[model samples]
Target: MEIKLCSLIALLGFLTIANAQTVFDITKCGATPNSDITAILTKTWTDACASPTGATIVIPAGTYKCGVVEFKGPCKGPITFQVDGTLQAPTSPDGDSWITFCSFENLAVTGTGTFDGMGSAIYGKQKSKAVVTSNGVQILDTKIGTGDDCISVGDGMEQLTVERVTCGPGHGISIGSLGQYAGEMPVKGIFVRNCTLVNTQNGVRIKSWPDQEANDVSDIHFEDIVLDNVDNPIIVDQMYCPSNLCKSKGASKVTISNVSFKNIRGTCKLPEAITMTCSSAHPCTNVEMCDIDIKCTTGPAKAVCTNVKPVITGIMNPPGC
Candidate 1:
């Protein structure tokens, strides 16, 4: 989806807002519990987005089924999607994204709601990728579980902040599987802090494809994170090729710089707690780590480094490279 010239704020779990005008409740638009509310939600959003002044769209408490839907607009005024109900997706895959928000001026999706993707029913059979391609986005106070990255920072993203999130049963927060296509925009100014990750495949990662177009990734930070039994807790793999599908051509041309990881303490499932395998052609620069204390479940934790030398200080448990 496309979101332009807007602050796309996602406040998950529970929210309370005062002075909300023009309330568009989905139930009033013909939605009932445990039934398909796609049309109702669409109508509600349409009405809300057309309001002369700011409007609020609410999905009240209950279980509801929904299909692939997109909320698109350069809205007339600021819009708030307040979901307090559970929105369950279909068992079968329909589209790339179950719900998408595109091209808004000011939008906030906040709630004590749940989006059940039903990942268990079709985990490995299909691809479930959540890509963020926007600017000025904030994901706060959220709990996420999935088969892929809990939050995947994609191209063209700037000034994004993810805070107070609990992630598990999935890959941790990541920036890029980038450089896969030509002419991808640069990603910068990403901040992820105060999060807890449990049983994740990886934690706080940056991965890009090898032998691709040159795009820059910089000014990334991950801080005050707690990981429990996570694998590859802190990693940066520029040669990211899943399933061995792509042949080795040359090193990634993606420039990675000014990255930092601080106050990260956790237990890793694997021995290699920190891995930084940067591109030989465009080596990562100005990388820093401080106050990291990760312990391995099987043995003493260790770090493996290649191509990039990081500045390290403060309470390194496994020792730095």
Candidate 2:
């Protein structure tokens, strides 16, 4: 077919020129709003925009303070850390993963900015955290406050998109405890839809079961959301993890296939708003819930629905966790 349409138009012009390299203008990197990125990439972007196939460093706004910021391979435009202000890190004596993303691609640290990992300016609890490795990611409308899990996804990541984000007071977005059995392409196409969590502890967490040989965190999806007073709003802890705080434990055997929680609306101080655990070697498959609405300050507001096939009907409070 004409050489397969000329090799799909030269692989879509080499992935649109590998996402269009470089662009940093954090107000010319001498930014104010309290600047001092401790040499944010040797003073504003590109100490190395890593090029085997990577580079897109552009931040336009103000407010600074940085640590452990890394991304490699496949980038064009959206490495944009564009916001109006704030991007911090430093505490826990200094740094662990203030912002350490891995094998990156198409990152968009959106506006309304603020990545303050002051993490209570660290004092232990292994000094708060951060880490998102290898993948095609897009984190939009950012405002993540970390002392822990304000975002952590590793092990050969895949398509990830945590859009319209807003997690405060830590430990919210997670994708693995891929410890103990060690690595692979575990985290798959994960989509955390329009998010919002305040006073957090565990707003939206999807993990592989506690170590054995944790498998694939398959095609998962979390829909339109909002939660306040969070303390375990939506979780899949899997059982015993973070190895009491990431010493790189284990747990995950893939297969959390096509999971979905659609039209989610919430409120949680946790009397069990949403809690999912599917393991038995990667169990929870093709799970779905539509129009879920939850509100809890007390209890009984949970309306569980398990492996629901064709039996879901405009659910209001149909939770069967």
Candidate 3:
């Protein structure tokens, strides 16, 4: 027993020291508060990604005006980016995304800060407030308001969990616009819960490009969501024609299955509270809904369902698909 206890203590001590090895504070590393710190932040991220012990890059409490920032990685160890401040994007009409992370593992960004897009200046130009591509990502307790999707999970992502997030004045949480290109990676094991979206375009949507080859999206869940006057609130638009000019030649080939929506209640601005416009060739399968109540401002809430049948339990506002 004594030897075991000593071994446990030694393990704990080693972990403590390992965690303390690389801690980078952006403010101390030549980042100016309330200014465009894109250059400074990029350097800090590079250093953190290169750390042998992995690192924790802290964005302390302050306002930072940033441009397009991308953090790509295969870091040696686990990495954490703690945002305790406001990160705002510039008003560039050609901006892509405010902050983008790609090809990471075991990354966590958690705090009480805000990711502001100032999107009105360049509406429809910015894609998302933040886009992440990784395995094992946790985004918690953050507020996002942007031009496009508040938080979008791209391809090459798995085991993603998002909780306690607030999104608005933008497109809501989304999984795709996948299957756009060839050789795309499959996205799986996604959970989005305890989210609030207000005055957004869509809530909890999974969209895919039209006329693309088959892609697999499975085992996804969205629960405990609150929508306030949102349009097209709870949608799985398989034949997503963003340009409204998709050729009537072919249907979307994305295979959407095993998706669930539960405990979602809110108000819809339009009558179509739930729309599941799946592809005719490859329809959505095994979709489920429960305890969903959405009220519309005008007339009664309605649902447009096609190419999919859902398993429903509890009460659905306008009847589920």
Top candidate by lDDT? 1
Candidate numbers, best lDDT first, in rank order: 1, 3, 2
TM-score of each: 0.88, 0.31, 0.87
lDDT of 2 by residue, 11-83 (tens): 3432224455544444443434565554444333342243334434444456676666554445433454555
For model 1, how does the per-residue alpha-carbon lDDT over 129-241 read when each residue is reduced to its tens digit? Answer: 64455555567778899999888888877777788889998899999888888888899999999999999999999999998778999999999999999988999999998
Residue pairs clashing, model 1 = 2-103
The runs of at least 3 residues in candidate 3 whose Cα sits more than 4 Å from the true structure, single-residue gaps closed, are 1-21, 93-95, 124-132, 245-249
Task: Estimate the Cα RMSD of every predicted model relative to the unseen true structure.
Answer: 5.8, 18.4, 7.5
Model 2: lowest-lDDT 10 consecutive positions = 7-16
Q: Candidates 1 and 3: which is better by TM-score?
A: 1
lDDT of 3 by residue, 19-128 (tens): 46566677665566888778777877776787777777788899998888888888877788888888887877345655778788888888667666675776766444
